[model samples]
Target chain A: EDQVTQSPEALRLQEGESSSLNCSYTVSGLRGLFWYRQDPGKGPEFLFTLYSAGEEKEKERLKATLTKKESFLHITAPKPEDSATYLCAVQDSSSSNTGKLIFGQGTTLQVKP
Target chain B: DAGITQSPRHKVTETGTPVTLRCHQTENHRYMYWYRQDPGHGLRLIHYSYGVKDTDKGEVSDGYSVSRSKTEDFLLTLESATSSQTSVYFCATQPGVAKNIQYFGAGTRLSVL
Candidate 1:
């Protein structure tokens, strides 16, 4: 069974604090790993897609790195505006044709100012 | 914001009633997906459509059915609503398998009482 697990269900960080969220997966074959940001009462917003091990992608204060067994989303000097639920999902090779993604429970981060 | 829209942003219905949620995309993407988000469970795929009239079940497809009669529309129906089905449902679209990047709608919050 392909599965995804995200650690630290909830985190409270002060403004300007940096942190990293973890996403680990066990899959038959990894086709892709995705990161998303979801605000309250809203749908998730796409963040990054890592296709292979050792691949890294960055956008502003956010950086995502992927490895064979896990992926990490690092937030640098996060502000209150950056507070949101971070979601991680994995696309198994078996579900490639349909583009199905198995998602994790997500990590809710709160940046207190 | 890939031009995806989900109807009935908020709905409250009784158990055993049939409910349908509509997802419309302006880009005429070939792939559309339905997922349910819940606390502690994350987001789980309910069903997906590869193309017009082509659909497949996802990890959590029980009691859910989907249809895509045209290129830009996807519908998800719950034959009989249950209390356990209360969730925030999301709709996503992907251009193709190769792209693998999915854009999401604002989501529909459903409550079954």
Candidate 2:
């Protein structure tokens, strides 16, 4: 079975702190890897999509990088506004262009002052 | 936001009751998906539709069904709600151009008593 695992299920950082969240996967073929940020009582927001190994993308302070077997979301100088649950999802090769995603449990980041 | 809206942002119901969650989109995306998010468990795919009258089951489709009779509307129904079904359900749409990005609805929070 295809699976995605996110590490450091919960991360607590001081305001302005920087850290990285990890997403590792084992699947037949990796079509894409995506990152999302979800706040409490809301849905996951689109972040970045990495299509292949060595691919990377950024938005504000969040940057995502991918490898053959895993992806990383790096948070730099996170502020309170960045406190949210970060989710990682991978598109399986079994799916066509219609697009389907397999997700991770998500890492909850709490940026405190 | 992609003009996606999920009805009954919050719901409380009893087990064995029938419940329907609706996802409405204005962008006319070709792909729509439903997922359940739970603590310790990642967001699991429940169902998806590629177009009107075209639907398929995801990894976790038990006790649930979906319909997409129009490009803008997707419905998810629970034949008989179970306590285990209480969760935050999210509806997402894939834009034609984004290979990995899926915009999401606000989500529906359901509680089964």
- So what's the TM-score on candidate 1? 0.98
Fnat measured on candidate 2: 0.79
Best DockQ goes to which candidate?
A: 1
DockQ of each: 0.92, 0.73
Candidate 1 local lDDT, residue A100: 91
Residue lDDT tens for model 2, A9-73: 99999999899999999889988888989998888888887888999898999999999999999
Q: Spell out the clash pairs found in candidate 1.
A: none
Best by the TM-score measure: 1
Q: Native-contact fraction for each model?
A: 0.90, 0.79
Q: Candidate 2: lDDT over CA atoms?
A: 0.90
User: Which stretches in model 1 have alpha-carbon errors above 4 Å?
Assistant: none
Lowest lDDT sum, 10 consecutive residues, model 1 chain B, at: B95-104
Interface RMSD (Å), every candidate: 0.6, 1.6
| Candidate 1 chain A, run of 10 with poorest lDDT | A94-103
- Taking the tens digit of each residue's C-alpha lDDT, what string does model 1 give over A1-32? 99999989999999999999999999999999
